[model samples]
Target: MKELDKIDFRILKILQQNARIPMTELAEKVGLSSTPVTERVCRLEREHYISGYHAHLNPHLLGKPPLVFVELKLQSKSGNISKISKRSAENSANYGVPSGVGRIRLPD
Candidate 1:
C-alpha cells in the first residue's frame, strides 16, 4: 500500500463521511479543482483503498429485527467436523453460527 499524504487522508475522511458528496463540492471543500479531486478518488479506488460503495438500510424498516448471538458445541476436531458444522449452521433456520466449541472428558 502507498503511504497516504495529508491530502489523501482528508479525501478519505470526507468520502467516508459522505460517499455521495459531489466531486465539485468535495473539490471546493478540499481547496482543489474538480479534475484533481476526481483523479484522486479514482486512484483511491484503483489502489483498492476504496473497496465498494453501499447504502445503509434499517433492518426494522424491512420487517427484520436485530439478531442475537447463540452458543454452540461440536463433537470432533477434524477438517470434516468444520465442514459439517458449517453445513449444519447454514441449514438451520436460526442465525447461522459457523463454528462451535468442543469439550473432552478424560478417564480418571
Candidate 2:
C-alpha cells in the first residue's frame, strides 16, 4: 500500500468521526475546493482506502425491539470454525440482522 499524505489523513480522520459529512463541509474542513475533494474521495474509494459508508440506525425507530447479545461457549474445538461461523452468519442473515451490524466486542 502507498503512504497517505496529509490531505488524505485529514479527510479520513474527519470522515471517521462523521461519515455523513457533506462534501462542501468536508472540503472546507480539509482546506480544499469541493471538486478536488470529491475526486480525492472517489480515488480513495477506488483504492479501497474507503471501503464503504454506513449509517447508525435506531432500532426503536425501525420498530425493532431492544437488541440483545449472547455469547455461546462451544464444548468442542473439533468443529471447523469456518463452518460454524458461516452457519451463524446464515442464521443471522435469515433473521434480518443488518449486514453492517457486525460483531460487538466488549472490553475485557
Candidate 3:
C-alpha cells in the first residue's frame, strides 16, 4: 500500500464534508482537472480510503422527532435501581416529562 499525499488527504476531507459534491467542483477545490481527480477518487475507493457515500438527513425528515436518550449503569442489580426508577417516575409525573433536580426546568 502507498502513502496518501496532501492532495489525496484534501480530497478525502472534502468528500467527508460533502459526499455528493460534483466531480468538477471537487477537482477545482483540490487544484486538479476532473480526469485526474476522478482517477484519484477511484484509487481512494480501491484502496478503501473512501468507503461509501451516504445521504445526510435530519431526524424530522425521517419522521422521528428528536427526544432525549438516557443510559443508566449500576454497580449491582439491586433494589436501589428500582428505587431510583420510581423516584424518577414520581418526579416526571409531578413536574413534567423530564424533570429532575439539577436538570432542565419545566415551563410554568
Lowest summed lDDT across 10 adjacent residues in model 1 is found at: 99-108
Candidate 1 structure quality by residue, lDDT tens digits, 1-108: 677788888999999999999999999989999999999999999998899889998766776665444546555665577676665555445443445433222222
**Candidate 2: how many backbone clashes?**
0
Q: How close is candidate 2 to the true structure, as a TM-score?
A: 0.57
Cα shift from native, residue 33, model 1 (Å) = 0.6
Per-residue lDDT of 77 in model 1: 62
Per-residue C-alpha lDDT of model 3 across residues 1-108, encoded as one tens digit per residue: 679999999999999999999999999999999999999999999999988988767766566655444444555556586676665676443333222332322322
Error of 2 at 93 (Å): 9.3
Candidate 2, residues 74-96, lDDT tens digits: the string is 43554665565665676543332
Q: Residue 35 deviation, candidate 3, in Å? A: 0.8
Q: Is candidate 1 or candidate 2 better by TM-score?
A: 1
- Candidate 2 collision pairs: none
Write down the lDDT of every candidate, Cα atoms only.
0.75, 0.74, 0.75
After superposition, candidate 1 runs with Cα above 4 Å error: 68-108
- Per-prediction TM-score to the true structure, in the order listed: 0.64, 0.57, 0.64
Q: Which residue pairs collide in model 3, if any? A: none
